[model samples]
Target chain A: MSKGWDPGLVLSWTVAVIVAGAFCWLLGDVFWNGLGRVNWQFLTEAPRDAGRSGGIGPIIVSTMLILLVCMAASLPLGVGAAIYLSEFTDSEVGFGRMIRRSLEVLSGVPSIVFGLFGSAFFCIYLGLGFSILAGGLTLACMVLPILIRATEEGFRSVPSEYRLGGAALGMSRTRRLLYLSFPAALPSVVVGFVLGLGRAIAETAALIFTSGYVDRMPSSLFDSGRALSIHIFDTSMNVSGGEAQAYGTAVVLVFTLLSINLAASWITDRWLYRESIGS
Target chain B: MFQFSSDTILFGVLRLCAIAAGSVLLLVFVFLVVESWPALSNVGLVRFFSDESWHPAGENGLFNLLPMLWGTLFVTAGSVLIATPLGIFSAIFCHYYAPSWMARVYRRLIELLAGIPSVVYGLWGLVVLVPLIRELQPPGPSLLAGIVILTLMILPTIALMADAAISNVPKQYLHSAAALGLSRWSTIIGVVVPAARSGLFAGVILGTGRAIGETMAILMVCGNVVQTPSSLFDPIRTLTANIALEMAYALNDHRSALFFSGLLLLLLIIVLASLAETVRVRGEVNV
Candidate 1:
């Protein structure tokens, strides 16, 4: 009985292996095709000849600037919402539930719809036009749900004993949150921030309209700038001989995402380790 | 007095931010309605459903979104069909068969897949999947290509959620099944799967939402032709693709019509999200 062949086990293993193999194939193909085109120059020079002959320097700058604006706008709002939901309001009640539901629906709202909204509300109504500011604000709306959810989980993990201790010491609620809960939840908040950053950086559809198609170096927040993801899309679809550059940009984007995710997991693991030791 | 005032100000600021965050969804809906009002009034809602094609420009322009709507649903349905079984099985393997370390690594891998940008997936689809499909058929970019790419894109969502669902199954049920001399497969199929049914359904619904909303990847591989796909190999365009492709140059009624398409997408997503939320809430209560 111990040695008999098990079809279920065999099938499951096969399915898992197939999925893993597909992932490896996809990542490997991108690297194999794109690595040759990436270098120091590619990282630091502006693209030329419609992105067929040069690097993605300006695109990288634009992506970073847009990410900066997105983070600056979303971090406070997301964290505040999380604090409001987790600390101030009862989760089982009306306003909290409504906020959570709205977030759920917003998270599920298609990025393309956000693109439309961003173009209408930010680019047109607000007169921001196709600029980094508009793109960042659009991403802020999109990233808010993810950030709030993760940060809320982090805040919820804080022991109530800590809060009680703060109260016993006559610490004000705001002071307790700042010195006790906020510090304790820093690891999760960082993880959430990194996740939101990754999403904001990888965004293409939401940024395409708001960020515009300009690939030059953006001098200010008001200037239109092409994002790395958009660059990848434009090169792959619009330009005829831009496959190499597209792959290069993709490699950069994937590596950025990989590093960010790895850093997040590392922080989570370290926090868990510290907890185990302290307890 | 200073401390109290400072605390009040901080709380006030945070409350304002939360309110702002919550109102964004409503604002998005209202703006889309306002922008699309012209199209809704001039073209009328009936034309949107009844017209023949999506010719939004020139004289006698047709504003029908049926083709794109069908394309979105058709592609989403196809991807869901392929991803659901594979994702469930993958989750099952990770939960029951794999060693703990392997399971951890595999779950991380899936998360990494989720983190990868949609544009990268789109690039890969265009360069790799499209060409592979082309060998099987004449034109490369087709509904099949879109489905395949979308299946890959949404697989991680389903797999991760299913994995969580499977993990949440109480250990007592497994113990009881084993005590009754049931086989592992039978325990999984009869007890664990049934126990996690609603959660898994929620996961599928969420994945469906993601697939429907996906734009760049599907846009790259679906050939972007505004036609009702006759077969899986035929070129098609999704509502998302239609909006992204045309928003650059569309004017007047054309632009308004795109906004209308977005409104439709928003409404569809809201329904899906609410359904998922309800299922999840019920599952939590039942568990």
Candidate 2:
């Protein structure tokens, strides 16, 4: 007998199509309504008018600062740990495995959970009181795991023979790592940084507790500023201008991310591609 | 050897710090349990697990997350239902049908999608999606809204992983199927799908982990309701949203419970991520 019609496939297919359709339409909607909200003043000035639906100057500026702060903290810590682990593996694979596995577990911990810890530890316990430092440190903690993993992968990809050759040529292990291993792995390590920073810029829930969504431009590290992600979240929930303003803010955030992430990804991808291809 | 003393000591401290990263994971569990002990002791473990209402630190102080759990399950299940098939299909097409040039372009777009933040996705949902669903009902931030947003947020991940999985299924398997008088279509369904089942599972697991941990987007779109999802268009909260919405005002037992919830959510991600990672390596072997 011929198999009866498999209705499950049909139903699942419909569901999938509808979901994809909704995402596509949402982007299309943004383009249509979003273009009208964009203006030269919107970029240069803070919300000159009262209420929300304001320009993104402050939020954009805050996000950039947060990125820089998180990068400063995570990069050295992450890369140093990676270098340690990768170098140690030549002699002591057991210790390397422990570091590697821990980094993996750390990466798996959710961002929101990190937000809680950060709030308790950074904002409250340390008396930082909901400021950029708290936000930056929290995001740094979150990104550190990913950065370590990526950098370790980069280091692992470098041929062991090269390191041995350097040692044989009278270069000390430290010098070998600094001049050869590091240089060889620098491109991928940088790629990891770019990826980590892009994620930090988009994060919100974590920032809510640490970053403090206080409106207007930041005066100092402790002054408390709004990030683009938090700004988008805060603007959406409120009743005032409602969906129209929310859409405008979203469009701005999306384009800002699109332009920056696209450039960063292109550069990183080309760098990684060249490394793989030349090898 | 002259300078080695200083540099070696530096590296020694660096090792302690590296090892300390592992301690942080254990520390999280300790901190959550310690901070939340009062509330857990007050409620007792049995009742905490059984109760369905979640109004901790209220006049009632009811801290039942069952409804939120139900909402979490509902939205995650619904999004998975949507993301899985399309991801698998697109992956199949990407693996077998698309030319190299188009494959690269599609891959790049998918990468861009991955790079876009969850908050932006939530923002997009709050703007366009919630209202559209609201047209179906009032207060557009419903379980439907959350599911739709999660589906979009999760699509790039599932597609990328699923593509990797299908690609991992060797050409020999497909060629063997074809040589055995099987049609291309039948060979794909019969041979490729079976071979890639583990990979597909990995993709779905990764996607689920994502949907589960998702906070900002779901928080923005899912109206903060402490009830089981009655309908697709009804407001509901998940564990993530519950923490985000309540944490700002929470204190004592209430805050502890939020910590408990966060701890629980992290444990879930760890479990799912490990499972996904295991399957991913196996899938890679197929390539």
Candidate 3:
């Protein structure tokens, strides 16, 4: 289907290049403006004078804490749900469809709405009172859909022949899933967790409601903490003289996300490589 | 016997997690409704939406949501208008025109774009785009800035979705169109695009939902002026921004009003999402 030069094709392709160029420009702007501020002190030292001076040490720690808690809560539950949907049930049938539809609905619910829900349920009603635990729980709900979908896809990708072979070997369904299917899906599942972690790391609104913006090291999950995204929001919008610090923080957040994404793609490529070899 | 079995226990645990996932949605709805009751009760549901003023000051209560709702709709529509054609064209180019290696790279780039956090987009908009807008029209933050930023923010989603849809179109159609002596571009526009139409519509609808529900990026650049924007340069507040800005200090009915705003956002999202779902299901049925 190699084509001669067509005006429409040229035009569409030009638009694509323009789109890609805009993306590159945006990334270039962020890195060029923000990367200069990064250093050992910036990464390790605590902020002073309402985050105008010093560094984003506590915010980094807080963000990591919330992310760690969120992953801990979401991964097991998400993997379990994915297993149940793809393995235990005929996903085209009643309960599985219901579960999938709920996920779709939940995924579409705005992050700000999740903020409101977290404020109401986790912060106020549940008496968690604006802490890392509260924020992490809110984020767990937020990431659960992505996790389930990815893990379910991973499980589903384990060929039917593998399942048939397991059954033929007189293995029960649960045993086979635990011993064979799940391990095969581990790479994809890890990829999903990294993606979900990227999102959790980036979240500001949902954390705003559940995680109170205390700009110091939190000793426990009950203490309020600041996340990097929220730090960017506060510094850029509310705090004075924080514009530079905000850009610096944005650079950190963006790079952190980039690493996660790179890890995911690497894992995915590795899985593909292994699959190709196995086939 | 089954109760004591490890397999039964494992299945039960998995099923419970699945149910927990679904139940979380239900709980969110219930919490939102309960919290929003005061505003709904005080202002009355009809007047709440219909009244033009949004003042929550002094003795007399006002919880009008029309202006912000209008702002949300306006910004979303503007973003959709800008992004839709560019996204579709990019998707088409990637699918039909670009070399396979280029398409693969484009796909990865789109994924990377999607992975960038919304707040980072906000930071970019605040530092970069807002300044550019300020030069065009003084005082930077306005509906146009919001629109432009949102358009950039959502481009990846729409492009990726359109790409997926176009890729999913069957190869037989292309073969047949080629047999009829249609050129590559003509075959795409005449046959392949038509086949992928409903899927692309679903993507467009989904993108619209993202643009509307978006908070951090738009909030950073939109100037947060609480009024119906009369022009692209006029700064305006969206429903999400209003709640985020005011929810901290809001008290009594004002707090309830914020929840009411959340309820409105939720309803809008539900409508957009279900509509997207319907379009997707319809596309599947057609296939």
Candidate 4:
């Protein structure tokens, strides 16, 4: 007998379509409202009146600077921690589990709390003031767990035979990890970086207190700078005339994040395809 | 000998990084508690949690968190209610109904959605969702706007988690259901979903954490009013929002009160996260 109309299928399809439609609507609305406002000037010129007039040049520079600092700080810490977990420690037992659990807990801490912590430690305790350095460090802390987790997954995916092969060659543990394991996990680690980049770009609250929301081009890491995300919040919340610029910044932010995520997936997909073929 | 020493140094560095990463969480707790103690001691812990008003600047300097706490709970609960069913169904569709290519695209799109910054979502809520709400009801920013934005934000988390849970259901269970002449829909409902219940529950819990912790998005659309919301249309402030909004200017008791609010949020998140972890562990054990 021909299957009558399946309500479950209908319901599931409806749900999927609704969610997908909402996503499309959101992206479309941002683009529709934001695309026209973006231009070369907007990308290069500094804000004139509290980001209410002129282009978001300084904001772009500030965002990139903060991201650069964040990546520089977090990459070593996160990847090293991941390597330690995967290679040196018995990750299934005591201290390793505690580390993993702590990462989990830290990841779940709200951005606002991180804002407070960032202000307390980096801005005040470290005497960085409301500077790019403090903001970047805060973001680094925020991203460390994600990076460690992703990089650890990469390290885990390396075949054990590589370890054995290295050992048979009388390679030291460091030699094995540096040349064999790390290279193999480099793609995954890159993926982690891209993910962290996306996060660092999107972060607002963590940077708001630490970064001090200055609309000027930063001369050094010590200088305060406004990020696109924080710019969006500031314009919409405090400023009266920066609404259009906020949309433009949002579009730029969304596009940047989307591109990073796409690059990440492409990298992971290529790696996985190669992995499967090699296997 | 040089190589060995270098290797030792490298390993030590890695171990140090790992230890530092682990200690960050403890440091966060310590800093928050230390900062929050001024308010805790000044107002006394009993009044902080028990009071209804959140006027840190008033003559009495009330730190009653019930209003903001209730606001957070109300918005979070509302978001959970909307997101859970939709996300679960979306997950089911992704796993079962969609073709392989469609599933792949959907997964990528969901990830993209997840990657979009919370601030963008807030901007969208302010420009689109808030006005939409205002058209239907005066005063654009309200609990409803917050809930809707939060529901959208958390969908990827719940959907992905549920999709994983659904995918992990044993193939044998489906095969057995098929052998019993149960339809695909019935089998999923009667067997597959039931088997994946704990995993789904854990997913929902994780989604709850995400929703509750969400600040900027809800902050933008939720009107940021300090009073407890009498209805979904009423504007409200969350604990996160309260701190974000007031931390810049707050001093003494007000500042400590914000820190104390942070402490309370930390506690709430810790509870939710541990519960999610417990459920996930239990699910793993069951499997």
Give me the candidate number with maximum TM-score. 1
Each model's TM-score, in the order given? Answer: 0.98, 0.90, 0.96, 0.97
Model 2 pairs in collision: B53-B64, B55-B62
Question: Taking the tens digit of each residue's C-alpha lDDT, what string does model 1 give over A1-279?
Answer: 254666669888988898899899899999999998889999999999989989999999999999999999999999998998899888778988888889889999999999999999999999999999999999999999999989999999898999999999988888999999998888888989999998888889999899999999999999999999999999999999999999999999999999999998898888856964774
Q: Residue by residue across A148-191, what tens digits does model 2's lDDT show?
A: 87788889999888888998898776778888889889887887
RMSD of each: 1.3, 3.7, 1.8, 1.5
Superpose all Cα atoms of candidate 2 onto the true structure and report the RMSD in Å to 1 decimal. Answer: 3.7
lDDT of 1 by residue, B51-88 (tens): 98788996678988999999999999999999998899
B73-147 per-residue lDDT for model 4 (tens digits): 998998998899998898888887899899889888888888889998998899889999999998989999999
Where model 4 places Cα greater than 4 Å from the true spot, the runs are: A1-3, B1-4
Query: How far off is residue B198 in model 1, in Å?
Result: 1.7
Q: List the global CA lDDT of all models.
A: 0.92, 0.76, 0.87, 0.89
- TM-scores of chain A across candidates: 0.97, 0.86, 0.95, 0.96
Residue B144 of model 2: what lDDT? 92
Give the poorly placed runs of model 1, Cα more than 4 Å off.
A1-5, B1-3
Candidate 3 to truth, TM: 0.96
Expressed as tens digits, the lDDT of each residue in A107-214 for candidate 3 is 878898999999899899989998999999999999999999889998988888888999899787777887889888888788789888988998888888789789
